[model samples]
Target: MKLTLDFYTRPQCNLCDEAYHLLQLFQDDWGFELSVRDISTNDTWTEEYGLRIPVLKYKDLLIDEGQFDLDIIRKRLHDLSSEN
Candidate 1:
């Protein structure tokens, strides 16, 4: 099954933009569906990720936040794929 990658972010955020671009670069190769969410649109999301925009999640598991570490996410994805 294809995994879904949830990206929590808000507008006018440089870090978020950079993370988004990075995600897009490997999205196809990573073989996961990217679901981008604007935290500003949801109260709960806003409260949960207001300070941590550009959060990356796979299901309930948080993959990365803030500036986003590619190595961490790559390792996690590799581990997750191995499980299946």
Candidate 2:
């Protein structure tokens, strides 16, 4: 199964940088393709997630704003693994 991390980001956003850095730590371990969507150039994404530069999305679920919990992410990944 391919897990997509829908990263909604703008140019030079510090939080986006930090979030991507954190996500990189587990990229190899998780073994999933990383897709970056620049909301700056995309109107729909920009309008929906304008101020929320860094957002984590998986399937139909969106992680709550201000909630980048690694433990929770780990658990979700583990669950996904078991499902596979």
Candidate 3:
């Protein structure tokens, strides 16, 4: 089973960049699909998530946002994988 991740982000955000990099590292380890969504490109996204950039979603469920923890993410990976 392949896990898909939604990463919400926007331009000129260092935290967004960091989250992207962290997700890349996680993808390498867990082999998941990552989709990046730039809030700046959409009005709805920009309005709702403007201040909450770098949010991560897994199957419509929010997993985390900003300052991701390797240990917590690793645990989430383990938990999600076992569901399959």
Stretches > 4 Å off in candidate 3: none
* Residue pairs clashing, model 2: none
lDDT of 1: 0.91
Better of 1 and 3 by lDDT: 1
lDDT of 3 by residue, 1-84 (tens): 678888889989999898788778768678678889999899998897788778888877777887777777777777888886
For model 2, residues 2-82, the per-residue Cα lDDT tens digits are 576676777888888887888888887875556888998888988988887688776666743333678877777667667
Best by lDDT: 1
RMSD of 2: 2.0
Question: In model 1, which regions exceed 4 Å deviation?
Answer: none
Best first by lDDT, ranked? 1, 3, 2
Q: Please say which candidate is ahead in TM-score: 1 or 3.
A: 1
**CA deviation > 4 Å runs, candidate 2:** 64-67
TM-score of 2: 0.80
Q: For residues 19-71, write the lDDT of model 1, one tens digit per residue.
A: 99988899888877789999999999999999988899988999999988889
> After superposition on all CA atoms, how large is the RMSD of candidate 1?
0.9
